[model samples]
Target chain A: MQRALTLAALALAIAFPMAAVPLDLDFYIGFASRVMIYAIAATSLNLILGYGGMVSFGHAAFFGTGAYVVAIAMTHGIDSLWVSWPLAMLVSGIVALGIGAISLRTRGVYFIMITLAFAQMMFFVFIGLKAYGGEEGLNMPHRSVIGLGLNLKNDATFYYVVLTVLVATLYLLRRLIDARFGRVVEAIRENEARMETIGFSTYRYKLTCFVIAGMVCGLAGALIANQTRYVNPNLMHWIVSGDMMIMIILGGLGYRFGGVLGAIVMLVLDEAISPYTTYSKIVIGFVLLAVVLFAPRGLAGLFDRKRVRAGGGHG
Target chain B: MNSATRMTEPVLEVRALCKRFGGLVATDQVSLDVRPGEVHALIGPNGAGKTTLVHQLSGTLPPDSGSILFRGDDVTHLAANARVLRGLVRSYQITSIFRQHSVLDNVALAVQARSGSSFRFWRPVRDESALFDEARAVLARVGLADRADVLAANLAHGEQRQLEVGLAVATRPAMLLLDEPMAGMGPEESERLIPLIDGLRKDVSILLIEHDMDAVFRLADRISVLVSGRVIATGTPDDIRANADVKRAYLGDELEAASGGEA
Candidate 1:
């Protein structure tokens, strides 16, 4: 019964963009694409924070870098996404490797602070690069062409592309969460010292998780750059990182659709409430507090009927 | 498995190990060796630095000065996980199994540690029948096969202790450092664990740090008594029973009480 509901939801997501195109609901379509991009970013953060137990506060470093990578490549006449998108992922991955190597050595709050420091450092580095428009931000010449005969310039087409990416990302992440790697990562979260005594080099596993999250978030950054046609140092700001964290918590930490649900709700609330009130944040804050006080597991956790049992499936 | 060939040399050798915390000496010039296929028991009173010595041996705590040789390789500098990979595994005095995991998963993780690289990111671990099969075999060995699907935290204290030993044993250790595996157990629970350790002697050598004199005498091939962070005596059970130094330092009336209770 739940499976049918989930499939129906997916079907709605696919058909909604097509229906919105004819109904002149272009603004909603663009908003939906933005939500998907945020969903990808939040889900990537979940891999490290929720699963691996690494509370990184500098995820924006990767997200901004991915956006910058695409914008910079387009300025250099690299208009094909085939080259720019992978470049964004690769660059973010390498950056994550370097940051993770240093940051993973410290645990708990120190880990969080160190990651934040690295991200702020990246933010400043980009700000210093006057050639890339510095604090003013850079504008893309045009959205990178897919060359597959689809018009990325169309809002509906871009929404479909983002939905496809989100679905693929979710599928791959699900596989990863159920795999041996995920089990080890989760075990490390439960008891790291035990993992070491059990012969696991836990540092390496954590570093890998950090890199994967960074790479995926980078993909989101690339899509967002295409969607907005703008890249800015503010994308790497600590506020962005905090926002992504909020989305994960709002959706439900460790659940597969936690990030996606959180992104949709958060974005929808912002869109609907901001027009009427300047205190929209205060309203959202109360909602978040209520969720924490009542639900404790976020929005996605509400659908779970049975209490988690021993040897049960994980998200 | 080839216990005969390795019997000529000590499987583990600790030399002049010392650890000092400021003015206090926790472990002073401690030294011991466990021969292949033998269960060497280290007995001591409270604050005798038995746990400190175990920490140093297992690479959790670095001894201020010591040389530890495992399988003839100097592993004093190796990390805990490195030592584990070399088949030097330890169970905690305070039962440290993964509390959130299932009883089967707790052992399966240990088996997975020893089997292959945990960097495998594609296939689900549930689909790995061989890993689960080996884990079940380990659970059966530790007498937890019936409770394999139960959450580890839900187990009774005695059963959790069994799972603790089960975790170490599943790692396929060459030498097991069991730090009071039967701690906080009733007499009946302790009675059940005696044969479990006894059964492991065929394939694995054991360095047991236990306070239970009955368990020590029954399981140990040789006994070393530690008092005031020093080895007072090292000999066979009967030999140590006769040693006056062992009597005065740690045992005193405890051995008599153990024998009396056993009878």
Candidate 2:
């Protein structure tokens, strides 16, 4: 039954933008695109936070770095999606490697603090660099050129691109979660000392997982930059990192669709409620509190029919 | 005891292992050896540093001064995982099985460690039938095949203990540092573990630190009594039972009880 529902959801997602272009509801296409981008970002956070048990509070460092890489690449005559997107991911992965190497040495709260410190350091570094518009940020010359004959400047076309990327990201994440790498990662999360005793070099696995998450998140950043046509230091702020973490927890940690569900719920709630009240954040806060109190497993747990085993993350 | 087996080199050799915390010396010049296929039991009272010695041997704790030779190679400075890769494994005194994984998965992960690099990111682990097959065989050896699918957290205390050993056994280690495998087990649980441990003697050497005197007397080929971070006696079960120093240190009351139960 859940499988059928998921298929219906996928069908709706695919058909919605097509129907929107005809009905002249093109504005929602861009909004839906934003949701997909955030979904990717949140899913990357989930990879480390939920599955690996690494509470990284500096995801925005990679995301913002990716955005900057794309924007800067455009200035240097590398505007093609193929080159810039992968470059963004590469740069973000390098950043995660540097940050994770240091951060992973410390665990629990220290890990959280160290990651945040690095991100804040990145934020400040960007803010100080006047060449890239500094504190005010830089605007993209235009949306990244796909060079694939698709008009990316159009909202509907861009929405389809983001949708495809989101689908691919989810598929990749699913493959990873089912793979031997995922098994080792989740087992390490469950018990690192035991994993070591059983002959696993846990630090290497965790660092690799962190790098992968960063690369995926970087892709989201590149897409978001194209969507907004701007890059700012605020993109790497600690608040954005907190926002990603909130989405993961609010959606459901360790569940397959938690990140996507969280991104959708959070963004939709913000969009739907903010117009009605200036104090929309207070309402959101209350809702989050209610979820934490009543739905300890987050929003995705509500849809699950099986009582997930006590220690096992969803497959 | 055959002269050929006695003349064979010890699988693990520890030389003057010492550790200090502030003013207290947790491990005081502790020296021991495990023959290639004998259960060498270490019995000690509370704070006797048996666990500390095991921790040092397993590479979990660094000794202030010591040398550990595994298969004649000095492994004192090797990391814990590296030591396990060299076939030196240890089980915890506390039950430390992965609580969220199934019994089979817990063992499968151990089997996965020695099979190959776990960096295979594309193929699903479910497709790796060899890992599960070996893990099932390990579970059966530990008498947990019936509970293969059960979550480890849901297992009874004794079953969890069994899984703990199962995990170590899966690594196919040449020597096992069992840090009180029967720490919290009931008499029946300890009884089941005795033959299981005895059965393992054919494959690996064991350095067992156990509080259960009955299990130790039944399983140990040689017994070392530790008191105040020092070896008070090292002898055969019969020799240890007759040793006055062993009784004076840690085994006085338990020695009587063990002998009575034996009779």
Per-residue CA lDDT of model 2 for B113-199, tens digit only, reads 999999998899999999999999999999999999998888999999999999999999999999999888988899889889999
TM-score of the first chain in candidate 1 relative to the native first chain: 0.96
Give per-residue CA lDDT, model 1, range B128-230, as digits (tens). Answer: 9999999999999988899999988889999999999999999999999999999999999998899999999999999999988889999999999998899
Span of ten consecutive residues with least summed lDDT in model 1 chain A: A306-315
TM-score of 1: 0.96
* Candidate 2, superposed: residue stretches over 4 Å from native: A307-315, B1-7, B257-263
Task: Please state the error at residue A161 of candidate 1 in Å.
Answer: 1.1
Clashing pairs in 2: none
In DockQ terms, which candidate is top? Answer: 2
